[model samples]
Target chain A: MSYLKEKILKDGVVLDGNVLKVDSFLNHQIDPVVLKEISNEFIEYFKDKEITKVMTIEASGIAPAILVASHLNIPMLFAKKTEPSTLSNEDQFSTNVHSYTKNKTSRVLVSKQYLTPDDKVLIIDDFLANGEAALGLIDLVEQAKAEVVGVGICVEKSFQPGRAKIEDKGVDIFSICRIASLENNKITFVEDEH
Target chain B: MSYLKEKILKDGVVLDGNVLKVDSFLNHQIDPVVLKEISNEFIEYFKDKEITKVMTIEASGIAPAILVASHLNIPMLFAKKTEPSTLSNEDQFSTNVHSYTKNKTSRVLVSKQYLTPDDKVLIIDDFLANGEAALGLIDLVEQAKAEVVGVGICVEKSFQPGRAKIEDKGVDIFSICRIASLENNKITFVEDEH
Candidate 1:
């Protein structure tokens, strides 16, 4: 976790409007070494949960989520940012998510066939901002009558209300790196209180 | 390869319009075991190519591509389907690609910093249909002045012209499972040719 914190400080850019652009080695262009270590850390944190599957939203979250799933030897599912409905998508679970960064509302979808009532899913994502994406994923999983074991985040913007929002649902949440403040174009971290 | 072909026949659904829906394990909901096998097979085939980095498009391609990158201990870069030009996306390598299945066109973008002139890249993707996505990735890589070693695909619809289109560019392409036909509600496959 300290290494991830250091990595964020080193490669993460504190842009205007409080955006930590660590896309260099975290999201867009991924470093496998970092991802491997991140997965192991998450596994150690959530190992005893008896997680049946790992899930995340599309695009950015897939890289780390898949690595964690592979290490746990479980299946990984992603809710698509629902495209132009071209298939038999009638039996899907979907919820609207308002992107905090992008300033848009879009539907996140997962087939009911994938998330069953018996699954204990571990939700993962690249970043936790306003908790919109995580809440949307939890909605989809619960719609299938499945259980969300917990939520694992690569980076959490603690200044935002995302952590509080998810904890209100009574789900255990763990983040590898937590940015206490991105105020005045400076990245500051707070110790993660397990 | 044989296991992959068997998985296609067993779990893959043959939808209307030559659409082979392998969502049970390949994409959407993924089986990490299958992904591990696919990555190993691709690595074995392209081991001598001196691949410096593994690249793919976002969402579906990230799972398999990241696994390959982890096994090879290198970096993985993905071309984004591009949001509404939010950040400093002015300096990017982008090209438009028409989705063969979706019946639409979208621009794929990669940051100029990731794909460098010194890179010997290997492309990994989930499916190859009309070769639009693969070609778009190749276009992005070449725009950054990087060398493309080969293309690795999880499934290829041989009935389509994807393979031929990529081969026309003189790129070595390998697919784990080659479906010779997906007509009349049947999933038929042909032997892989090296």
Candidate 2:
């Protein structure tokens, strides 16, 4: 988490008043070395839990999910934003998510064959702002009758209510980097106990 | 490669004499152990290349690209299918790609900050059918004036024109599993050299 914080301070761009852009390493362009460290950090945090699979959404979350899956030696399932023709029509679970960034509500889906009652899922994502995407993934996991062990997020905006909303549902959450504020164009971190 | 072939025969679903679905291991619900094997196979294929970065498009391709990048201990950059609000407004290298599955065309963009002239990229993907996505990624790499060392595909449909179209661009391509034909719900592989 320290390495990720350092990278963000060095290369992360602060836009507007609330957005923290880390396309240089975290999202668009990925640093596999740093990702590996991030992956280990997630594993370390969830080491006590029984995680059968690591689940995430498409695009930004895939790289980190894959690395953490590789690190923990667990299978990863990403809910696709665009449904491919190869997907089976009969056996599938779907949900609609609103993205403030894209300014559109799109349906995200995963095959019912992937998630099952036997699995213990760990939901992971790159950013936790409004927690809409994470909530959607949690819905899919619940539909499969699988217990979500916990949620691991790379970055969380403490100014937002995503953490409280997810926690209100009784799902434990772990965020590697928590942003306390982005005031005066300066990035601030939340206390570790938060 | 043998492991991949076996996985296809065992779990792959043949559809309409044109599609082979390996969603169980390659996409959708991914098997990390199998992905690791697939990643190792790609490493073997491009053993002699000096790959500075591994690149792919979002959604399905990100999983394999990260695996390969981690295998080589390099960075991985995934092209965004849709520009989120978090991304910069700076000029990006964009290319249009037509998806046969969705029967649509979409723009794939890579932040110029991630790629540069000095980078040597290895493009990887889950399925190479018509080569539209691969070509778009190659275009992005070239737009940055970078060298595309080669392309690595997990599953290639040899009956399609994808292989010919990409090879025509004069870039080396390696596919771990090549399907020669899919007829009557049967899957056959193009003779494996390995």
Candidate 3:
């Protein structure tokens, strides 16, 4: 986690309106070494959760989610934002998610064949700003009668209401780097818990 | 590579009109073990290429690309289909890509900060059906004046014109599993060279 904090400070850029762009190493352009460390931290945090599958939403979430799933030796399922024409089958579990960046609501879908009542899912993403995508993933898991073990995020804007929204569902949230504020192109980190 | 061949034969479902759905292991619900092996194979194939970066598109390609980048100890960059509002800056390399699945063409963008003329890129993707995404990625790399050493594909639909399109660029191509034909729900693989 300290490594991520240092990398964030070194490579992350804070834009106006609390947007922390870690595209240089985390999101758009990724450093596999840093990403592996982040995935290991997520595994260490949730080692006792007995997670069966790592769930995430595309496209930013897939990288970290895949790494976490690889380290956990579990399968990873990514919910698709676009309704793929090939997945025309009606046997999918889906929910509507509102994207603050895009400012629109779209239905995210996952095949029921992957998630079931016997599965314990860990939801992972790159950023936890509004938590709508995580909520939508939780909705998909619930529809399949699967248990959500927890939500793992790479970066969380603590000043935002995303944590409160996800906590309302009673799911434990763990983020590698928590931002207290991103005001005036300055990043303020919250006190580390681990 | 035989593992992928067997996996595709066992879990991949051939849908109507030559669409091979490997949602059970490749695209939707991913098998980390198989994916890791595929990444290793990519490393073995391009061991002499001195690949400085691994480039892929969003969603499916990120999983394999991240793994390949990790093994190669390099950075991975994914082209975004939608121009993120956060990245509204004009300092990006963009190109149009036609998605056969979505039946639409969209611009894929990569930040100019990632790729440069000194870098050597290895393009990775899940499938090489029509090769539009690969070509789009190649275009992005070329826009940055970077060298595309080769392209690594998990599964190549050899019956399609994707290979011809990519080969026309005079770049090397390596596919883990090549499908000679997918007619009448039967997967006939091309003879392996390695």
- CA RMSD for every model? 1.4, 1.5, 1.3
Considering DockQ, which of the candidate structures 1 and 2 is the better prediction for this target?
2
Query: Residue by residue across B87-125, what tens digits does model 3's lDDT show?
Result: 875879999999887789998999999999999999999
Ranking by lDDT: 3, 1, 2
Instruction: Name the runs in model 3 displaced over 4 angstroms.
Output: A192-194, B192-194
Answer with 1 or 2, whichever has the higher lDDT: 1
Q: Could you give the candidate ranking by TM-score, starting with the highest?
A: 3, 1, 2
Deviation from truth (RMSD, Å), model 3: 1.3
| Most accurate candidate by DockQ | 3
Error of 3 at B61 (Å): 0.4
Tens-place lDDT digits, model 2, residues B1-194: 47888888888888874777788888887888788888998999899999999999987888888888887888889888887676555768899999887779998898887899999999999989899999999999999999999999989988889989989999999988888889777787887542
lDDT per residue (tens digit) for residues A108-191 in model 2: 999998899999999999999999999999999998999999999998998998999999999999998899999888998997
DockQ scores of the candidates: 0.76, 0.80, 0.85
Clashing pairs in 2: none
Query: CAPRI band of model 1?
Result: medium
- Per-residue CA lDDT of model 1 for A44-162, tens digit only, reads 99999999999999888999899999998999999898552434568788899998677799987888788998999999998998999999999998899999999999999998999
Runs of candidate 1 exceeding 4 Å displacement: A84-87, B84-86
